[model samples]
Target: MPVAPAASLRSVRTLRGPGPLGAQVPGSGGAYWARLLPLLAALACVTRLPSFRWPLWSPDEGYLAVQARILAHGGELYETVVDRKPPLVPWLYEGSFALFGDSSLLPLKVLAVTAQLLTAVLLASLARRRWGDGAGRTAGVLYLLISIGLNPQDAQAATFEIFMLPCTAAAMWCADRRRWGAAGVAVACALLAKQTGGAVLLPVAWLLWRDGASRRCVARIAAGLCGPVLAAALLTTPSGFVFWTVTGSGAYASFTGSELHVLGRGLVNALVLAGACAGIVPPVVRVLRVARTGAPELWLWLASSAAAVLLGFHFFGHYYLQLMPPLALLGTAALQILPRERTARAIVATGCSCAVFLAWGFLAPRPDLAHAARLAEAVESRTGPKDKVLVWGIHPETYWLADRAPASRYLTAGLLTNYSGGRNGPQVGEKYAVGGTWPVFREELRRHPPTLVIDDSRGKPYGPDRVPSLRRILAEGYRPVLRVEGAVVYARVGRGGEGEGAVRGG
Candidate 1:
């Protein structure tokens, strides 16, 4: 790999102005705007183009959307609707739902696009502070390209990782500018966005200490980090916040496959990421070689992000989003030193790869919503708008599409069955649910009996027969009303069709 030359390194240092973060780079005037605006405009188009056609990008979106709807209607987080995720994302969705009405996902999609653009802009500014105007723009372009240069499910989704990136990038920029308190606030927001986002704090703290930040400065950052968290705790049930985000998160992370399985999955994820972002190879190599003194904090940031990506051993493509900002900065900076011809080739290659992803995102058949749509339709026809439904699997989409509330705080059966998407095979840890989730699930169902109990397990681990309480509930009051695409919809015997009860299907 062609590393950035020594001359380029010295040139960047000279361009760093006076202070680390507050340095005013040359050519950041009208000329910079002239070059940057077109690129940003292009970014806006590429980033949001796919989502315009398909509003609901992923199942996670459905989960958050439902949670936000619940929050909007006087429900509390964790107590009323639950997911083992931080509160910021649901709150963000609630704001969108409040503003645009939860019927359509256009508002949330727009927010996601704006976040991507803002994150790219922040990264560009950081690169400009570190390198120069050209490098900054290159970094921004690279970020926009690579972020969505994956399957639509991973890239276009308004996921936690997507929302987390801007805050993480903002923290990096603020820390570089010696704004400790602001950086800390950004860090807190990032952490609130996703657990992996806390990784950025390592690099930010390192930079502060390396720059000889005083005790008061450190105190300011600490306060910034704690204030939002305290506020969030007060807004929601603090105990629920700690349980879902921290305690439940611990168990969820630990529920992975064997060592061999994990290693295989990790290798595949790494290859997918590398192939998608192949243009950054030379830049990554350059950063590895020169980061010791030239950009130590960036190197640390990249390292920390990588560590975060490896968590849970399920390196889903979206997890790679955490790496893009830092990698974009380091890689674009490295490109500054390469020969003009080689640099053009790298950028062109990257553009070609990005174009492939964009084309697939737009041109490919819309995701297979047929089965889920059918299931939701079956549910909607039978249940009233105010009716509560329970799903016996990880199908949050059913709740969203049916436009019904959930009977239990456990939105998905994964919480009750210890079944993860890719981590485990057919085997579910029934014993794992012993740690209070099962009891809570049973109690929720008992208190607020669902009008419909839809078993979307499809012979998966958490089938109706697998859980004793679920089976008893079905036998005692619920009867199979309809079967849509392998999923059986069981309506309460006395609710939807009180007198038309039939024998439970085999």
Candidate 2:
């Protein structure tokens, strides 16, 4: 029940259908909002609860949550813990931790669902304003269909993309109504949430200018953008933010055509699905005709979003979440073009819905996270409440799942090998991860050793080209007591007594 900002309120009077003596009704606006928003909110909650209840707990979720937990414990960003994403995501995680406690993944998933619901509401509002209530409701359904449908570990719950979606949709809703200032603020929120989100601004400004908005109005938008940008700069270390979001981000991305190939497959699949839904002709017409009409903003959104999506080689489905709003709108249009009154068209829509969902059934994996739970249980069984643990590899989620502190600042080797570049940084010590190699990890392990270490062979392994830090540590000081789910738990040899020798199912 957070209070709405002055610029953004769900004024229910605007939603009221034509009625006798509408203006004469007392307290009607509140009732309308109370009734309608609740239903939409309830629908959103119900639809997304399945994902929350059956969590996949991806590495992205784990890494982000661990960093936020570090920050929550009075640790500094980059220096205290490492990640390449902007400050806003960690801040959200910190907030979730602060309120819900850092032990379970429930808080983060709840926050993600809340964001998704807000995005759905904004989409519905925007669609309703543009077309009608039917269109608005359809837009909401489409968003949920895409978002909750991809409920696998692919995106998890609250990645940088999911958290930023509400803001992205809010910015769109505002811009669609010519509220440039509010739109700009919302856009800035999106950018702060994730660096990729900044790409949407170009199309936003272009839309404002092309729509003949006055220079003063556009200036207000610029001012709004500056407010958040300046505040974030003042709040975070300027050098750190720039290095992580820009330099580190660049180095992390592979400068190749690998992502483009995957993008083509996704495009083809989406086109085929769209064709099936409204037929090839109507969808094609909708794309062309809608671009020329007042909804030309969709084209700009698509262009900007495409540019953002092509940022690197590894492109996940969450990267495309930003397009859901505009695509939802477009889908609504495609649906509208069909005469639902006719049995043929009705049957076609129903068949398409079933077909699309069936395809998604193949695409999204069922929640089967016994491996993560087992790892967490094993690690928790070995470590004391205050004892720290190190998950050496890509599985930062282990830290969150075990509810343990990281042995050192670094979350995963990828953060070091990928985003990090400098050698003089505080986190770049002799051990843990020096020059993002095994030597640094070894040093970190010896210097501030964790009680229990979970070794993920799936991580960027040290071989002929790299040094074997974890293997060396395992040989020198650790004893494998338990192994399960492609992960090996190494208990510190001398740290534990005779009773702590081995875990069951080793």
All predictions: root-mean-square deviation over Cα? 2.9, 9.0
TM-score of each: 0.92, 0.77
Per-residue lDDT of candidate 2, residues 1-506 (tens digit) = 33344312222222221221112223354554565577667666655554564544467777887888888888887666766777888888888778888767687777777888888888777666654556566667666655543324443456788888888888876776677899899898999998878877876776687667798988989987878977876677777667766775544464432345555646654454343334323543543433333345655776787777767644455666666666666666555543445324433553465345445434565333556667788888877889898776666777777888998777875554442221122222223232343445557767888888776643233211243444566677777777776576778877746225665464
Question: What C-alpha lDDT do the candidate models reach, one value each?
Answer: 0.78, 0.63
| Per-residue alpha-carbon lDDT of candidate 1 for residues 178-203, written as tens digits (9 for 90 to 100) | 88999999999999998889899998
Worst 10 residues of 2 by lDDT: 14-23
Error of 2 at 388 (Å): 1.9
- Model 1 root-mean-square deviation: 2.9
Residue 72 CA displacement from its true place in model 2, Å: 1.9
